[model samples]
Target: MIDSGESAVSDSILFVTHSPQRSGAESVMLDLAAECHRRGMSVSVACPVGPLSESFPPWAVHVEIPHLGRDHGRRTRAGAAWGMARSMVVAARTLRAHRGTAIVANSAHTLPALRLAGVRSVAWLVHDHLVSRKTRVFIGAGRPLLHHVVAVSPTTASALDGLVDHVAVGRLGVDIPDDAPTGALPTGPLRAGTLSVLTPWKGVDVFLEAVARLDDATAVVAGEAFPGDVGYAAQLRERAGHPDLAGRVTFPGRVRAADALAQWTVHVSASIAPEAGPLTAMEAMAAGVPVVATDHGNPRNLLADRRGVLVPPGDPVALADAMSSIAADPHGTAAMVRRAYAHVAEHHDRRETVPALLDLLLGTTSSSAPAAPADAVAAPSRGGGGSR
Candidate 1:
């Protein structure tokens, strides 16, 4: 826990997020907001009313705004722009009302609105790799408005190299209980699973393909699709029913991370696109599940030095091979799991990250602050339900 004795920096801190969904970035925001509140800072969150709102700390203020950003499949480009414009107006009003509160934009979509509001103490927590040219241009244009830019990983920080100066790496962290379930590999037929929202780029399709190659493994794809990606989710369900996957695959809708990890012998992160820093992978490591992640973004760094297995992105054969190797070599898998657990404890523990982020936000730092690493590529820009 961060000390509550420091002198107040801002009267309050307003956390602005574009989407209402409780995905990776939003999850981080919730944790950060809770910590801020714990430290006796006035905390408020502004976002479209949805599941995320329900998850906010009860004491924190909730300011509703129009859904911002492009919902690629569900809305026309012009419609998204109009929605964003309306959101900006609402956000600007909120900024005026909360005059001295430092602003924390949880997604790039909120940047324009913060810029419109003209708040100088803005911190943009970059969660995804911005691959779209238009998003890069828009964020770059608003760069002057951001007082500090912190990324969830070194790879994510690299993406903002020339676009934003003084970009710092603040890696995502997970809660690791002292008695966290850690031990030898489970004794049973291989059970593989992944915890991610159902979306095209997340590659649930690729995961199903890999599951098809595992003759005896039962697999679970545990997450719900947003409104815009229902068609893609349906396609994944249809793919699961094919003869190859047949009764072996299950669509368990969204389960709690701990519940999902507890049921799986092997956890997979099969995103076709590069992920900035996936919380699910980190959680699995902390929970003692062997991880097989795509070789891109933060997974590459997390799984380096044989802490876990890294398969080529979008390659079902490689994914399948990696899964099989884990099941076949329990001895090796257990060693890797132990190494992974230690690595997460030393680096990605929430006990460390949450305070680091609070210090960064409050403009205070202790000897424990993590040093910024060498920057590397722009990440995929996030929006309402696309390109995350």
Candidate 2:
């Protein structure tokens, strides 16, 4: 398929990611890789050995390196840099062996490393809204080699204004299985819950504080702390053990969004900080569960017709009232949930969004290409804290 003169790039793609976790970003990367290979392009992924590495199929090549994680806040700057430097050295050697037409960096962690290795035509997929001064300098230095950037949300895209030369929006997609298990409406005490990684910024604490106020509603919190934030989850458990929260609040710990949504009467997204589009929230909407999300960041981008309830971020009083309201007006909420479910099906389906993501990666979309729908800008919430 290639001419002799054009030897460097030949429809091969190399995907680089930092850690092999079940996070939303990793899910998108694996889904994208599978889609690319299905389209007849050669694809391979290079990541550290961890739980998620096993999820890659036999059709895709997997290259393992030292295990990777986020920079610990308590670690000294020099120490963090040194550890990353060692990982970079090994990753570079692996990259050199797997030549491709374009190299894709799944997160900011891999972009600089690939840049330092002199990899050509590198594409950076912005999963989170990263705009640190240090990150800016590193990306700026590597700007010459960059092909473009694919941000998951408009907020993320807007954040990249001065940081990168070319920017594209990639919305997150959800695959609704025909055989997806259906959940029944609750008949007893109002059971409300949320599925999210337990972190301070994720605002599970806010969810808990609000749940403490609703005497008629029982709450379930699913999701464990990620690698870097175990202490925060421990604190949540300690708080859940408080006498006031006693028998009302439960921590189920790291269940799939589908299972959690099916178990609860209402699904909630109570993040305090801005989040990219969260797949859990999208999946919940797809499953016909009523949603209550904070009115900041990517959630604003998803619920266009006010399908889900929105509350002020960090306000436990407002969040509690929203959850209680959903539990009270089942018939009214069911009518609203139908509209929300239809909105998700029409827009956020993976079948439609994956090709759009590949188009951005392959430089296939042109100026005359159809304008982006609002969903692409708030497509998938690939934020580090929301899923996984």
Q: Return the TM-score for each candidate structure.
A: 0.90, 0.87
lDDT of each residue in 296-370, candidate 2, tens digit only: 878887765767889999999999899888877777787777777777676777887777776776666534234
What TM-score would candidate 1 get against the native?
A: 0.90
lDDT of 2 at 221: 86
Instruction: Give the clashing pairs for model 1.
Output: 129-379, 129-380, 130-379, 130-380, 158-376, 159-377, 159-378
Candidate 2 residues lying further than 4 Å off, grouped into runs, are 1-9, 67-74, 99-101, 177-185, 365-371, 377-388
> What is candidate 1's lDDT per residue for 94-176, written digit by digit as tens?
76665467778888877777677766657778888754776775586567666667778877876666666566667778988
**Displacement of the residue 330 alpha carbon in candidate 2, Å:** 2.8
Clashes of each: 7, 6
